[model samples]
Target: MRYSDCGGLLKISFLGKPRIEFNQQDITKEFGSKAIALLCLLMINRNGYCNREKILAYLWPNSNDKSAKYNLRFNLWTIKKNVGLDGNGNEFLCVDRERCSINKDYEYQCDIALIKDLLDDNIDDLEDLETMRHFFNGELLEGYYFKECNEFNEVIIYERNLFEVAKVKLLLRLAKQYENRGDLDSCLNTLEETVKFAPYDEDIVLKIMEIYELQDKNSLAVIYYNTYKNRLVNLLGTQPSKKLTAKFYELSKRPSKGVKLGKTDFDTNNKQRICIKTKCINGIKYFWMASVIKSLLEVEGLQLEDYLTDTQLRDLSYIQPDIANSLGETSARTEVPDVRIAVAFVKLIEKISDSIRLKIIILAENEMDDFSRSLYEYLQDMRLHVDLISE
Candidate 1:
């Protein structure tokens, strides 16, 4: 468990990829597939005795019992011969007729850096912090798998969960340490890395945005906000919370264009309903519009099933006949989408509003495609409220 300053070393790295070294020299290549798998089984058990039958079933499951036992013996020999010795010239493995295990006295080191440091509360150690600042080399045992070994893989899944929990904790601690030092650059870098895996974490997102604001990087802050909002809508069938939306406006300095949802009226007269945001884009004519429709449908009270056919409801978020589909094309097809499609969309909104109040934000008016621009104007003409926000 301890890799630090142990001269009697069987140093093994379990993070990123599993590798073995002896006396500061790599001996990973000396072991064959079954040998390494057998070794991992023992190590995962933390030097406990592994029954011979269990080892045989895990390592050579397809072989007959006699052949499996023979294979286990051969791999045990391979492991013993190659794992090398300690500073006091002691053997690392202890084998008997029925079970095998590692010698607890030997310095057996495996790199579960995140897991180790977290348990020991070692993040504040300056050297360890620097080492972990960019420690996303890969996940534990990256790309290492035994296709035929389901049981071993199950243990790996259980352990991977433990590693991931520790990893997130480690990154949060690392980012906090950087921020405490007023090292905004390192803090931002670490936060961004954390966001890659923990995108749904609102608190972490807030931290990143707060740092950006401190550094007066508001443009990136706005971009990040919109990107995250889009992700939430697309992936979670939800939008960012009001807190995140308010933060966007505060950081973006675009509050005037935002209508507080509570004060907004959803009447038939439709004052200022087309919330045009002049920032951030795609296909079915203007593919981005479907995402807009999806955003509207995602509201809690909107029953898309009531408004659309089963097929349309099923593919609503992704498939847009207005912009991307060609199944209904005919010889009389217009050079552009028939205005009826736009009318259908407006009517759909009308129905949705009658059932439940809604507010829509069309991001990036300046960058929006021409057809989508026309749709916004049409919505405006239909007497919908247009809360336009732009650079």
Candidate 2:
């Protein structure tokens, strides 16, 4: 059943600091710590009766049977008195001399119970996953401690782990949904929200880096990678996996010290690089840096090797990775401004069009990008028949 307190029935929040609200009133302060803990116990075992002997052992293990039973009776009374009944006048707790339980038929909303129900399986509904995220304000029963019940605390720890995993699962699913919708900003935010909870999860970290790379936020990717790597080193006394490290290397790439001739020459293997650094290209000054960038990337014979990340190649499974290298062909990595690839792509299109007539149609010509505009102008130079249709 969907979690709700529509009828103002007993509602308990066991995820964070234990809270009880009946009829929309905060009655949590009226109950003692033991009483709240007892409510949590009953809620955990809501599906079936908790044996009276087991309850006594968990909550009052040190007390003799007489005192233990007395304590249990008093706590139960506190619960029943505060929780009272639902709208239909049905009691919310099932109490007997032999056992105790939360009435299964009771109309109520409990945060922990809701988490279990929602996380019973993988969730696809974004609303349900987001709703589950709101309940994890803190750990299970954050303010309560039952020093006398080691077993109960152990149970708390176990449940806490399960709740944590489910929370991460929903968060990941939510991120994927956002990503699929092309709301990358929202997707990135959702993933970051989960880092506070699952810092050690390499998969989450890997995903975060992938989004950063996709967004061309290489600096942020490096920052996040260093932060995570340092965290692992300090907290877990370990290092990131090779894949993660390789991602970092890919994102953290920079020009190594080499020759700085007034030309764009990049030879990584020989550690040689030539840059015009200033707002100029090949000793020609430009009033704007944009002009310099344009000139830099337009150099003759400037062939750049652009390698795809595994994620980018995820959909292109048929394109075997490093196929040329496997066949003893040299492959190189190139930095941004992969205009060389664009020039080559346009050339390939021109070559293909030589044998077969090709008509290029562009939508929203007003919003045409620089690359497309350049390609269009280049095609015009080739005297290719062109037509513009506009309303």
Which is the leading candidate under TM-score?
Answer: 2
lDDT of 2 by residue, 218-312 (tens): 54565567667756876799999999999987866743344332332223542222233222123321122232223323432221122233322
lDDT of 1 by residue, 77-128 (tens): 8888887778767788888988888777776556563346434665465456
Candidate 1: 10-residue stretch with minimal lDDT? 270-279
- Each model's TM-score? 0.61, 0.62
Q: Model 1: number of clashes? A: 14
The true-versus-predicted C-alpha distance at residue 185 of model 2, in Å, is 1.9
lDDT of each: 0.63, 0.65
lDDT of 1 at 339: 57
